[model samples]
Target: MTKTIPNYLRIHRGIDRQDSTNREQSQNLITSFWNSYSDATGWRIDSRASRKNNVLELLPAVTSETPQDHSDEFTPVVGRIAATRLATAASNLTEQVLRTRECLRQREAELASSAAMIGVEHDGKVSADQIEQSLADAMEACKCDAAALYMLDEDTRYLKARSVVGLPIERLENPPRELRGSRGDLEAMVQDVVTIDNMTAGSIDTWNSPEPFAAGICVAIKVDDIPIGTLWLFRETTTEFGSTESAIARLVATNLSLLLRQAPQAEIFDNPQPHQAIQEIAQWQYESLPVGSALAEGWRVDGMIESSESWATGWHHWDVLPDGTLMLAIAEATDPTATGAMHAAVARAALAAHSGYRHTPAQLIQRVSDTLWQTNTGEQLVSMTYAHLDPETGDGIVSSAGSISALISSRYGYRPLISSLSAPLNTSMDSNAANHEFHMLEGETLLAYSKGFATAGADQMTLGGHIRTAMQLEDRSPLAMLRRKLIDLPLTQERGALTLLRT
Candidate 1:
């Protein structure tokens, strides 16, 4: 093939000549012929090589003459050479395309397998132990003295330590740092990677780690373009991290992000024995149900709980205050074990205890937040909706935190009521809760539910449509109907909801 290329080029260069006036036109004509040939053959020849002293450049220039007039003594040789070059180019282009496709297929297969294995290992739930193990592995990979992973809370306002190795958890989470300020973690997240040569320079907030030494590297853990958390590697000596260390840290952070994205509801506490765990889970489930429905003048209130898991952390409550105000609450903890149930219980108790204070919905949420902080349970992820309603006028104010869903449905239609963004309860010391004021018209109802409702194949929009369809019927017990519909769906987690109807 190499010998033929040179011979072909030499023979083609000897037979082509045209006037300078027609030279440019001849070159364009030659280029057009090759381009047409390439299109017909579906081969992408290099344009630069084609323009150079190649076989295609030696074609006889076309003029105002017959086809036979352009044919020369070298016609047979030129035809043979062009055929050979086209055949070789086509083979090489096909081989290159196949190789590129194979590489892409291999990469896709690897990613798919990784995702499948992750799903199988965690079973859609990442535990505290798993995160801690990941931190330890990352520390070992980076050859660091300690490692830690800090994830944003529900509000994305503070970075809380999700897992730690070679450092006290309390020291890392004593006071969670804000996500907006000029800190090492924030810088790493914004800049992709950051290194700190001095730990006490105030640029990197170490939370005053005990026995902390000199240097550290912070790598942002993100899923796609969204920043989820930061991975930190600490060294005892003041040494800068090399490219290899930084790269390994990035890989570890990427894997951790996959786990985090897959399992947003992480178990943050130690797992008990299977038997003890089952028993505690059962106890939590039993205690999560509301005592009964609330009754007031011209008001109807009811709630339901459904779960297929061994434990569910959803609860509902309603109480009538001395001033004829109806207090309603629905909450679910993100933890999937007994710990989550305990957190939900704490939130429920806080709401019940403060119902008599005649506080507005926002004020009541703040008080509950304060209670959670005082009880040392403010760090847990809990979504809740608390409301205060006047039974006489059906006027109400509701506040939601985290992902709790709420809407108002009537004969007309249904629309979401909680649009304000707020972090889940206990996520922050200062709860920046927003209050949504609404008036429940006659024959209208308020529905508040947990994450399981959406996870069970029904989103707020779908549920609204369903409610609209159900309202067309003359059924007095719409809540029961909706509960039955939800029960029929495949269960993935705990589902809890409460409905307040003004008749």
Candidate 2:
């Protein structure tokens, strides 16, 4: 017997008619449906039948006393209701997409504003501590609680906590080793660590003692195949950290990883690249502060700017604040708008967790700044992502702007960092997209890079595919693995640097 749900309840609860009835007697059908498909949840359907007349209306009928108002057109009340519901859902989706896009714009504006502080002259120099404070201000702008930074030792044997925000400055000044051995008591060992909802007990104890954090995520920062370091995040109880929060953290990490290599200073507003001496470039770094501005209520930030001449043709740069948060910025070889649009699309994709997309210079420019890239017709999006990593716990974020294949390379192979695609900056959006994350172990290395590198080849698997393969083949150390896969891979001819850190 095929059981079904009662028509009235099903209609009221938003169940489709197909599952609400069957050939069997109405009661028997419902009973059998429940018995057979109890595990199934309700589904959606479209119908125009009047609830009162169709024997399924859960609410009172509209008063019929009112005379017919419109003569040219007539829409059934049920149809109107359905249309309204659909409109509401669509409106909600649009609002969400716009909100996410607005977030990107705001982040960019913050970076631009900070860049101005560094001056176009490139005469500014910010210290690591100042960078941490700036990052804290930026994180405050984003409503984050606490942020930290971890840098890989030159030997690549261990990752150390270098800076922190929203926590005790003393702790930030002298952060405890983030990684711990299994069976270690995290509660007793960790000073200001907070727990995150996503971590599982088994997974938390997989590597390092007690795990560095009680529940927060630690994003991996990589250049090429080496694990450079990470940014760590935490918040008090009551707020459940979601995928966006984690992604933002990872974005900060990537930025810092790149910046630390160039300017390991404490003050940021004091450097100028004179004449043609190595066309000076500026990178941004950040830390989330405890206090936030009213306009950016609940947010704080600290950032760094550095001068680098590497990849003058393509985009490449990252920065780290004193506390360990990271900031990453890159320029592509494509049109500006396409680059922005591509990044926007990538952000949406990361939010959605769909299969990756490969970008051309044209696509990248279109994605980042729809009007600017279109009007100026410049090639390159100049995108950025801020994130972090924690050696104590193999957890972190990996957000990007037109960047692809940030991954963890293990002895087994390289694993791509996956994220869900939200709504594209302007194109169609997908709210059902699932946000994805990558987990790492002690022997692993974080691999991060700009999109220019991935799309540089012409093999035609799409740049994303080439990078994906490299990440999956996490054999040997990250640098070694990167050299083997990227050096011989028939990717595009463009050049870009890879950042890495290993435990």
Candidate 3:
């Protein structure tokens, strides 16, 4: 019998192959173009120049005194204009390249951070024994008679039992539960945790188990905020699950999710290729922050991303909607791996693509969450703040998920803008986000940032104080002042921030 490849494994292989091919083609094209250009110009290119400064050094500097009518030279005026234009273009390109490199470095740091957090070795394999042991521990900790782990199928249409204890595995596998409707498993996934007072009650969907159980509790298994499966525990008595049991169940489920994510990847590759994984992740391009700033009649928006020497995943985006409303968003991923960056990218793209639809801040956030769920990449959690402001009136609405921070700063002082936050995107199937309305008067600024902005052990007040001090410097732009104030802080993690000043 031929061994069949799983759908997910095939998909990963195809993606990896395509990425490799694209990189090779890009390098070849660059080499060919440079060779042809050098031949045409009769300029011997410096092969030893550093990557950082090579682009500028490759172009010959134009001089004002060059002859205008010469077949090979330009007039003084023409030469000056060409030189100025070339300089400007080179400067912009160089800046963009530097920014891209910095972003890549930050993402690498995030991947390392994620690896440490998940406590998984670079070998990629997560053994079945480890998963079984986790389930046994959960059962012992929760004091449940039996437990079952149902993982989502490849298509995410059904939940299939992957591990079982104190129950017949064949019984649970007879018919996998479809992931639709208000079934116990689905409810647990949506609500995070569900408790059944009695298994015989209508609230529990037992699927007619052979062994009768009195009570049960189910907790959603999630990586990042995306639900991947459900963990069920059964009891012989109708004892309600308390906070301790619920917590232990959730913890076990969390560990299982991480292991599950790795198991498939390991099985598909069948080899220890840690370097390849890191390279592929590093080369995976995410959406870059919007270039420069945006300006309206009364509003000026400037954004900055300061990558940490440590782990950081942050992005900020701003665009002018068709109706002249300025849309702004800032997000941070909990895990600093490719999955986390992709989560931020998905949110950013959804926000930009749907801005023309005129969705409110809360609605926009819901759309991003929905996009993330649909993609099914649940390896990381993304916290975001979405806002839209009427430039003419400085009236705006802001909504946040997770704990992303938003503040308003003026001559009075800086204070928090988003008082409450909902669960992060992919955390739940439904949106619990709420929009907060605020008005910005002249000389007031609105600043939104990811957790990366705060150094470890620092409180909100300390972050606020830094912003207030940055605001006091009237001679510089808000973004510039903020960057200068906080860039030197000892950051063990990454930070991203966006600022809008009403002048």
Candidate 4:
């Protein structure tokens, strides 16, 4: 053997040496990469990203509570005012802006006056007598023959009369909390205002106040995006609710809501300017109801959010484009105060303003980042999940910023998903960040949420377990499921938002 080594034996020895060299080199390279990468960026890209990520997109796991739409158009018309519609010229733009500004100023003044008239800003407490007097005052303030204030029952669905003024004697004697039976045409939770000149011909039974009522205006009163009650101004005459009239009624209704949300009947009886008043103002200022009419059919979205800070903003929104693309998004502010909420709202307004140039979530996030930076509001970071899901295929293109992720369930169990950590909508981050697309099989649903949910969540595992069961059920509802998981937490306040999307 020593005299003559065979060629096969010689080749095997060489291959073993080569394999050893390659292993040593690979180990050295990985070590150097980790050290250099962490030192340079202050973070490490997960090794798992190589396995889960495609070239550009990601799939997250989340839905609704419906978010308020942030459209710039405001009109103080018969029902509502378009907020800001740009004009052709800087001069014309200046004039139009002035016009809009004046309208809002007048509108706000009217609201403040009407709310103040209801004894909202009084130094003393609120009473049944005070509320009844306010209803009477509101009717007179709006120059209507009658007014009724229906507060949301604990169920937060049916509006029962908390106070009533100027109704038929019979209705006043036996006031029905429910204005009408089961509603399909209009979701009371989503609608802001309604005006009917003629009750019978309006085609909505809910709007028909009652017999002997010829016209009426109805307004929803909400706090922190949750509807608490409704204010209705009924007129025996056939006159319509003009723009001024509608705006006045809405202002009165809005402040009335603030009064209720701030002064529990007890607090109202105790103090006029409750500490919660400022927070309520901030929350309601930019936060509004989503334009449900713009959503596509067969899709329902719901969201639940709690803010620890008065300025903290949690929002959910969805809209349909000209070409049938459905976009849904939920956002949370990092600062957890009104300033943070304002940042989130500004980000949303920027997104809506440039919607013409953005179709996908990627483009939208990128544009939003740019807008924030350009507007100098990029200091406060906002975490968000924006996605487009095709109802036909149940496949979705999801773009995320910060700690947004998705979940999908298989027979084995629930799996958390995301390729890697992406930059939040910040001036410091790269605008060319990638988006991920998730293709789902039958029975798999997606959940999207702010990372804060993880921090606020009392039982993270229980939340997942509930969501898993919901996914497996034939008649699953994301709203009911999310409410169950997040409701009645040990913590008095939470700063997180959640949204769900289904096939």
Candidate 2 per-residue lDDT, tens place, 455-476, comes to 4452223333443454456333
lDDT of 1 by residue, 1-503 (tens): 45546432332112122332332222343356555554444333443555433333233333333256544532332353565487567546756855764454333223322332432444344445556677788888777878876766656797765566776433442566777754777778788888776666555536343234466888887766767677788776555567888788878887777665444233323442357767776776677565545477767788877766666687888888788788888888878766887787778788778886657888888888888788873476678888888888888888888777788888789988874446887777877776788899877778887778777788888777666655667445667878766667887888888888777
What TM-score does prediction 1 earn?
0.44
Clashes of each: 0, 157, 4, 39
TM-score of each model, paired residue for residue: 0.44, 0.25, 0.43, 0.42
Question: Local error of candidate 2 at 234, Å?
Answer: 93
Better of 2 and 3 by lDDT: 3
lDDT of 4 by residue, 1-503 (tens): 36887543532111112333332222343356445533333333334545332221111111121122622232222221111111112225445755764454334323322333342343333444555566677788777877766555444445544455665322333434453452311343466777766665634445545333556777777665666656778765556467887677678876676555443455445543426777676657436735323144555565556555444465777776666667777776566656776788877787678665537788888778877777773486776777877766767887788765556553235666553656667847555555787765655545665665565554345555666677666434654666676676544444444444444
- Local distance difference test scores for all models: 0.67, 0.39, 0.65, 0.56
Lowest summed lDDT over 10 consecutive residues: which window, candidate 4? 79-88
* Deviation from native of the Cα of residue 56 in model 4, angstroms: 76
Best by lDDT: 1
Q: In model 2, which regions exceed 4 Å deviation?
A: 1-313, 326-333, 336-383, 419-438, 450-477, 488-493
